[model samples]
Structure formats: C-alpha cells, structure tokens
Target: MRDLDALDRRLIELLSREPRIGVLECSRRLGVARGTVQARLDRLQARGVIRGFGPDIDPAALGYTVTAFATLEIRQGRGRDVRAHLARIPEVLEMHTITGAGDMLCRIVARSNSDLQRVIDRVVDFDGIVRTSTVIALENPIPYRVLPLVTQDGKGLATPRDAARPQGEG
Candidate 1:
C-alpha cells in the first residue's frame, strides 16, 4: 500500500480510538468533509489496510481462560494438510509458518490446563503432524496493539502528524 498521509494517519487514529463513531462524527472530529472521510475509508479498505471492523473479543471472557502457543513439526510435504487439520479445530485461533526449528506456530486457547492438553492432543492427532511443543502464557503484560506501528515511520520514529500532536491528545 502507499504511504499514509497526515490526514490518513489522523483519520485512522480517530477511527481506532472510536470504532463506533459515525462517518459524520469522524469528519467533524478530524476537521474534514464527510465525503473526504468516506473516500479515505473506501480507499483504505480497497487497499486492504483496514481489514475488518469487527468487535475485539477476549477469549478469557468466553471461558477459555488458558492461552498457549504451540510450535508444530509437520511431516515432509504435509504443510497444507496440517493447516487444514488445525483449521478444523476451533480452539486454534491462529497459525503461521515460521523460519525456525518448528515448521508452524499456533495460538490456541482452552478452558483450563487439562483442556489445553486435550486441544494439544487433537492438534497432534493428524498424521501430518510429526511433533508439537507448547508454552502457556501466565500474564499478558502488553496485549496486542497496532496504533504505535501505524504512526511509526520506517526508521521507528513517529510520523510528522503524530509527532506534532501533544502526548495524550489523540
């Protein structure tokens, strides 16, 4: 995607803060025309920058209090099969191919420690999976966030628009 301009940055920041805010409200808050705000949103979506506006849900709130990451070693020539197997299990939140000792990594959740073992057992039940290693998360000191990355330049400094704004203003 193309680089985000000052207006784009500000608009994204505003939207990220108040996802339920209406387009007219966004225009008023960002000091832009409603049409401009809509057009920017359209372009951002078309460019795949804004993936979705779905509500963010915590697995813990759903009674799946246990969170763990599993690194899987798949059999040769079974990557696709292993992915399909993982996808069939609802507990597998996400999986990714990584460049490391393991072939794939998965983020999973469970109701408890014993439930996690059951999830792991199901994960490795597929013949395509060779072995698995998992680690449980004790506490999430810093949850997932992307606002900082959105305002960061390639050199790890804040963009001019973000820098000009005073701290805690956005």
Candidate 2:
C-alpha cells in the first residue's frame, strides 16, 4: 500500500468500482486535484497496489448454462505446458495451478452437460494432461467479487505480486 493515506484508499475504492472513471471526475469526487489523483493512480499501478478492472459478465445471460471445474494432473515435466494447452480451450474461463491434489484447476462453462463433457474430454486428450476430475456446479452462491484492500483498521494488506493469493474463489 506504500503507506496509502485516506485519499489513496478512496481512490482505489473508486477505481475498483469504475476503472474508466476520468481522473478529473475522480478528483472532483474525492475533493482532490486531478494531478494528485493521476499521481496516486500511477504509483498504485506501478507498485501493484491496483491491477486493472472491467465489467463482470453473466454466463447465463451469454447462454452458458453449465459451469464446471476440472482438476487436471499433468504428465511428468509438463505442468507449464498443460496450462498453455488448457488456455487454448475456449470453454476454460479460468485456470489455476493449485497446491492440493491437482496440478491444475480449470473453470469452464458450457451450454449443456454434453458440451461440458466435450470440453473436459478435450482437455483430457491434451498431450501433457495425464488425468482429470471434474465437479459440475449446480449453482453459484456468489459469482465473483474482489477483495477489500483497506482493512477495518485503516490499513491495506500490502502484498507484492508474488504474494497475492490465487483465484480459488469457490
């Protein structure tokens, strides 16, 4: 957080809500100068305090009715290659290399169970993917939400990029 003051916290909260908000508008809302907002944003981004943000799309609205997570075990010496392979699959919305039983975890969406099967089977057929286990989600209790950087104690969990947690948001 680089000892972020209240103004910096306000800026991050505002940016998380709307990344494209103009600096002038942000300044007006925070009662700070546009240049000050710009400087804070630049520092935040440079120090990895704030990444990027965009819209959150609904899979159901997009006709993807099925959501699944696939746990994949890679062949020897092929973990990195397996991720690249899974990334090429259109259905794989998110991929993570977890520390649990699986080497890679993939989130996929499909229009139907058969479609989901096809997607997972494609991943299973990949060269480096040795085995796979899948958990088809019946419902998503919470979709996706970002973390609150500023804590209750008026402090932010300032972690470097390497220390940030994974997206195992179940």
Best by TM-score: 1
lDDT of 2 at 72: 85
**How many backbone clashes are present in model 1?**
0
TM-score each candidate: 0.91, 0.80
Please report, as a residue range, the 10-residue window in candidate 1 with the lowest summed lDDT. Answer: 161-170
Score candidate 2 by TM-score against the native: 0.80
Q: After superposition, how far is residue 97 of candidate 1 from its true place, in Å?
A: 0.1
Which residue runs does candidate 2 get wrong by more than 4 Å? 154-170
lDDT of 1: 0.89
lDDT of each: 0.89, 0.77
Q: In terms of lDDT, which candidate is strongest?
A: 1
Residue 82, candidate 1: how far off, in angstroms? 0.7
Query: What is the TM-score of candidate 1?
Result: 0.91
For 1-170, candidate 1 gives per-residue lDDT tens digits of 15787788778888888889999999998888999999999999999888878898999999999999999999999999999999999999999999899999999999999999999999999999988999999998767777767777656798787788666543
